[model samples]
Target: MSDARPAREPGRRRLVLWRHGQTSWNVERRFQGKTDIPLDETGVAQAERAARLLAGLRPTALLASPLRRAADTAQALADITGLPVRYDRDLIERDGGAWEGLTSREIRERYPAEHAAWQPPGGETSAQVAKRVGSALERALDELAPTGQLVVASHGAALRLGMSHILGLPEETWERLGGLSNCCWSVITEMRDGGWRLAEHNAGTLPEPVLSDDRPDAGT
Candidate 1:
């Protein structure tokens, strides 16, 4: 989305966080998680290319979601960046609750009550998936020095939520940012003055791309 921040012509800590590639769940439109699912063959190719592209940037450190798909995606880049990948649960996908593995239509038909209960403004009451995202993001900013380049391997929802935090977006604006695709990234740079700016968002590098035809461009 169009981050209204004036591009900090040159910024400190060029933090680049990206989501993992597609999975079988993605193909069938299901919620994935601690399932230990590997990337699909296409996802492999996408991660490979994305890794190659990011390799030269030489990130100072790499943090990733412990999930297999995300870890796999991080490996592609780590293979190049030579950065160690540390695990973090904060990067986990928002649990879909009773609808964990079901599609949107399936959720409506099967677990409508649970579906209705889980709104965007606030994730599962005590579950607090957003809190995890926020904590991890805050940790990244707090723990990781704004020195060299940085990269985080995470999921679509968390990445979007983190980006929302980066842009200082209202909770209602979540719907506007939309969903992210496999191996696509929203590159952002942390400005020196404690602010952030967007580089490019949802930039696809998938070799056998699972492209989203419906995702809109970043904007206000």
Candidate 2:
């Protein structure tokens, strides 16, 4: 008799939206925008730790922004999972143009109007970011198996905007979605109706914690 288990229907695929680790500019509350800032010591450590957890999830594909911060973050996962990271410019942070590197207070003081509107002088609109990121994510999803998962390492704004688009949220309501903390991630899963759903947002853990101290040994 054949010992093979019966074939099962394809399961929902997952897309993990991850924000890159913190940078010096982030600590200073500066607008990193499209600037390529390398991660600080703490940022590196964060990436490594998050990678260890995410690797256990068996992500089948890794994708990242070409910017140094995001690339480095994704590299950590690549190191653990032995998966190659595909860089996409569409995953880069929103273009801040003249606002890049400017601290939040400085931007407000120098250009109150633009600050209120949250638009940089020559920067990209949120709509533009959402479109590009959404397109890239769609392409990545096509490459993933129905039961497989993909991890996308990118900027806070970029990932949030992309996720909003994927969920078909209205442009005016995109602001309702909060940004992800450094190294934190969101999970999106395909629903049975073929629509995407936000299963988890800003989840910082892989093996979710339980309430009691009766937890078994990790290796168990």
For TM-score, the strongest prediction is 2
Residues 111-141 of candidate 1 have per-residue lDDT tens digits of 5565565442223431355567766876766
What does the lDDT read for residue 146 in candidate 2? 81
How much is the lDDT of residue 183 in candidate 1?
A: 83
Best by lDDT: 2
Q: Which segments of candidate 1 are over 4 A away from where they belong? A: 1-11, 113-127, 205-220
What lDDT does the true structure give each of the candidates? Answer: 0.68, 0.82
Tens digits of per-residue lDDT, candidate 2, 124-219, equal 888998999998998788777889899999988788889989999999878777667788899999988667999988889553221110001211
Backbone clashes for every candidate come to: 4, 0
Model 2 Cα RMSD, Å?
A: 10.5
